[model samples]
Target: MTRIVLLGGGVGGSMVSNQLARQLKPEILRGEVEITVINESDTHVYQPYFLYMAFDQAVPADAKRPERAVLNNQIKLVVGHAERVDREAKDVVMGDGAHIPYDYLVIATGSRPAPETVPGLVEGGHIFYTEEGALKLRDALAEFTGGRVLVTVGVPHKCPVAPVEFTLMVRDWLDTHGFESSEVLYTYPIGRLHSLEPVAAWATEIFDQRRIDSRTFFNVETVDSEKKTVTTLEGDTVSYDLLVAIPPHLGQDIVKRSGLGDAGNWIATDRHSLLMQGTDNIYVLGDATNLPISKAGSTAHFQADVVSSNLVNRIHGGLGSVRYDGKVFCFIEAGNDEATYVKFDYQHPPKPQPPTEMIHLYKLAFNKMYWLSAAGIL
Candidate 1:
């Protein structure tokens, strides 16, 4: 049997697992292939719902589901920590010392929030990347009456447009929930809303309208939790009653130790086929790749479609070089019951297209699609 082991059961991993289960026929699946996923968490998260944390739009109950429910039963589900991989030997090693052999490997390990890397962050403030973090932030948002609310962006983040959405959405929420007494501050190392110029320009206007104080090109250096102060590398300090932080993301140490990482320590995959540099049977997908696209769930869904087709082609020993356009079609919730949609790839991350109410509806609709999609019911 051709054993295929996938890692990290997040949005990217769950989507790919579901697609693989669907595309492989019964006959081929029985004798030719075996699929399994490795993950540390038992719950799958609808990360976009994290928007609710600041305004209480959604809760922990809204974003989580049993991880197994999001995957296909036909595939084995291994719940454990993946410590490393033996690419040449075709096996995965767990933290508990158990080794699972594989014919093909897909590294969808996803990303992790590293608050410790930022000085005084862990000791001073909280983050919202995980379930616990979200819950804590929810409480903090609800309890605080009003003060300077700083939502700082750490360098090298996932979903680059997220901070923009956070800025605008929080404005709408505070105004609705009577928390408009407080001001919001957005600080980032970069000078714009998005790296792409067109999108950045649009976001800049939004920030100004919301009355959000922003400092561009200001790299945050430390957080003095007791003083509720955020110190920038340039010696500027901003005080806050509640601080919402977006910390730098890093790959699982497994990739770095395996020597499969790139300059930023992300997995090095062939940009065209999504395969590892030195191995044909191994593949990497989602944010793990050093691909030039926003590390968004929609990006993973599109890449998974391409990777599944390309993997099947290679199984037949056909030299099919299926390339990804780095395509991404995601909804940007701009608040006021309005959202923007962008469909572009690495070649063009920004499409200065017009905005429409249709995008807002689609953003809401995506949540329903996601729950169904994750359950393999769509």
Candidate 2:
């Protein structure tokens, strides 16, 4: 039997497993193939909803579901923390010292925010990347009266446009709540509003029209929570009443412990083949890969299609010819119940459309429909 193991059960992992289970159902039933998914959690979370949850627009129950319900029945679900990947042995070592052997392996372990990496950020800034952080930020916003709202962005973070979305949303929130005296200030690490040239131009135009203040080339060096000030590496200090930050992200610890990742714990992957560098039977996808693309859910969904198709073809004794083109799609909230979207690939640059209410509604609809996507139904 050919044992195919998925090291993570996020959207990419789940979609790939379900796709294989359906396409290779005959082989699976005949006991000629086995598929397994190993995840650290029993529940899967739709992380995009965390932004909405910060404003009480969504609840925890809306973003979470049983992981078992998200995967195909033919796929085995193993819920435990992985200790490391023994590539030479072709097996994954569990925290309890169990070995799960595999003939083929897919690594979809996602990235995580590391707020503790920044000096004083954990105590000074509000991060909405996780459930607890969102709730805490919500409470802080509730008590806020009128003051400067600072939105600082860190590099290599998931959801590149999220900080921009939050800044726009909070600008509207202050207006709606009658906090007219409040100020909204956004800072980026690069010399522009966003990494993408077109996006930065669009966002800069919007910021000017909205009277929102912005600063570029502001690399955070440290934060003084007691003084409510953030110092930058360029020798500047900025003060804020409420600080919202997008913290730097790192891949799972297991990837680093296994020596499969770089200094940041992200695996060096072949951008086209979606395979680990110098490996034939192993694949990496989503935020786990050190690809120079936006770490968005849509990227994972697209990569999952390529990985699953290639794996299926290989199982049938055919050369896996499928290649990923770095496709990524994202919705940008433009406040006032309006949104815009961007779709681009390796060969094309995204041209964002004008913000509209219809696109905003579509984003909300997709949030609820994310489960279906994870099940490989759409």
Candidate 3:
């Protein structure tokens, strides 16, 4: 059996599993071939609409679909947390006392927020990084009348633009809720408003128009929820009534303990090919990889395409033939009625520019597409 083990059950993992199943032949991949995907969670989240568009508390039910629905029937999906990859033994250690061997291992374990890493954060402040966390905020947002609302990003967060997006959406929501006077602030690690140029221009302009206070170049050292204040590494403190903090992300604990990660515990990989260095027969993708692109779903979708093609070629005894372009598309809400999208393909030498409404429509309807795609209907 050609045993293949895929890690994680997120967007990136599900997409590649579907593609690879279509390529690896039944004769070669039948009983002789075993396809296993190890993931911890039972539900898969459509992360795009975690905020405004799908504001209903019940959205998580619709967002998560069965992992088996996304991949073909030939693949065997296992529900468990992988402790570490034993590259020397070609096996994966599960959180439980079990080991799964694999001919080729694909590490798709994604990133996670570490709010507790910040001083006084877990004990003092509130966050909306996960579904449950945001659900708590949903209740918090409803009962609260109005006060200083802060949306701060810790150093190195996935979906880097999300804090800004959430901030604007909440401001709009608050205004609708008759809290127009409530102070809204945006704090970031970067000097500019948005990390990307086109998006930054659009966001900076929105910051002025919507009155979203922008605080740049400040590193969040600790969050004091009880004191209702946030302290920075630069020894400055800011007060907040409600804090929507984006926590620093780290690679899956499995990869970190396996000694496959960098200083921050994110896995190191080829900048272009998405393959694990010093190890063949292994691939890393999305937020888990050391790719120099935004850790958004669009980036994962594009990376999966490249990894899928490359894995197929490698299986056929051909050379690694796929090259991944550092392409990313981000949709920004203009806060009134329209949205702005930005597209970037690193190969082109042109500077970043504002994207058209086509990207907006694409962004809005992505959840539906995601549901269809994840359900294997696509």
Candidate 4:
């Protein structure tokens, strides 16, 4: 029997496993193939919902579901932490010392925020990356009356547009709560409000209309919690009454420890084929790969389709012909009631669509569609 093991049951892993199960049903039923998924937690979170959850627009329960509830029954689910990959022996070592062997391996362990990398960042800043962090920020925002609200972007973070979304949402929240004295400010390492040229132009116009102060090229060096200040590497300092920071992100420790990661600690893979560099039977997807795309769930959704098709080809002794074109789409929220859509690929950069209430409705509808995706129905 051929054994296939998928690491990290995130969006990429779950989607690929679901597709493989359907495509290889005959082999699975005949007991000629086996599929197993290893994950650290039983819950799967719809991370996009975290933004709405922070502002009391969405319930925390709506953002997550049991992992097993979303995966296909034909696939095996192993709940454990992956320690390391023994590529030479073709085994995955678990934290509890179980060695799972595999004829083929899939790595989808996503990236995570590392706040500790910046001194005092954890203590000084409010973050909304995790469910807990979002809830905490919700409470903090609720108690805020009038002060300087600062949002900073740490380099190479997930959800490239999230910090901007949060700033706009928070600005609206302050206005609605009658905190007219509250000043909303934004800072980024890059020279523009957004990495995409067209989106940045649109965002800059919006920032100007909203009177939101923005400064670019501000690379964060450290945060002084006691003084309520953030210092850049160039020695520029900004003080804040309440700071919201997107912390530095890194790949899973196991990937780095196994020597499968690049110098930045992200897994190296062919941008087109999604195959891990220097390995034939191993593939990568999602935020784990060092691909030049936004580390958003939409990117993972598109990549999952490419990876699934390529994986099936390999299983049948055929070369993977599918090539991912770096396509990504995102719904950028301007405020509580309006949003804009942006779709692009590597060759074609993002062009902003006019912000509308309809797109906001679409974003809401996507939360419902997410479950269908998890169930492999869409």
Q: Which candidate's lDDT is highest?
A: 2
Q: For candidate 3, write residues 1-378 as lDDT tens digits.
A: 667788987878887877777777564445655667787876677776666532343456656776666667877788887888888899999889699998888888888889878878777666676778767788788788799988878767788677877877787787878999999988877788766665667778777888788888778888776789988887889998888888888877787788888878777788678889877788888889877678877777788888878877776778876888888776765444446666677764224334355655666777578766653346
How accurate locally is residue 132 in candidate 2, as Cα lDDT from 0 to 100?
95
Predicted model with the maximum TM-score: 2
lDDT per residue for candidate 2 within 78-124, as digits (tens), equals 99999999999999999999999999999999999998988999999
Worst 10 residues of 2 by lDDT: 172-181
For residue 317, model 3's alpha carbon misses the true position, in angstroms, by 1.9
Cα TM-score per model: 0.93, 0.99, 0.92, 0.98
Candidate 1, run of 10 with poorest lDDT: 347-356
- lDDT value for model 1: 0.78
- Model 4 clash pairs are none
How many clashes (backbone N, Cα, C below 3 Å) per candidate? 0, 0, 3, 0
Off by over 4 Å in 3: 28-32, 53-58, 348-361, 375-378
Error of 4 at 344 (Å): 1.1
Error of 2 at 82 (Å): 0.5
Q: List the residue pairs that clash in candidate 2.
A: none
Model-by-model lDDT, in order? Answer: 0.78, 0.94, 0.76, 0.88
Q: Which stretches of candidate 2 lie over 4 Å from their true place?
A: none
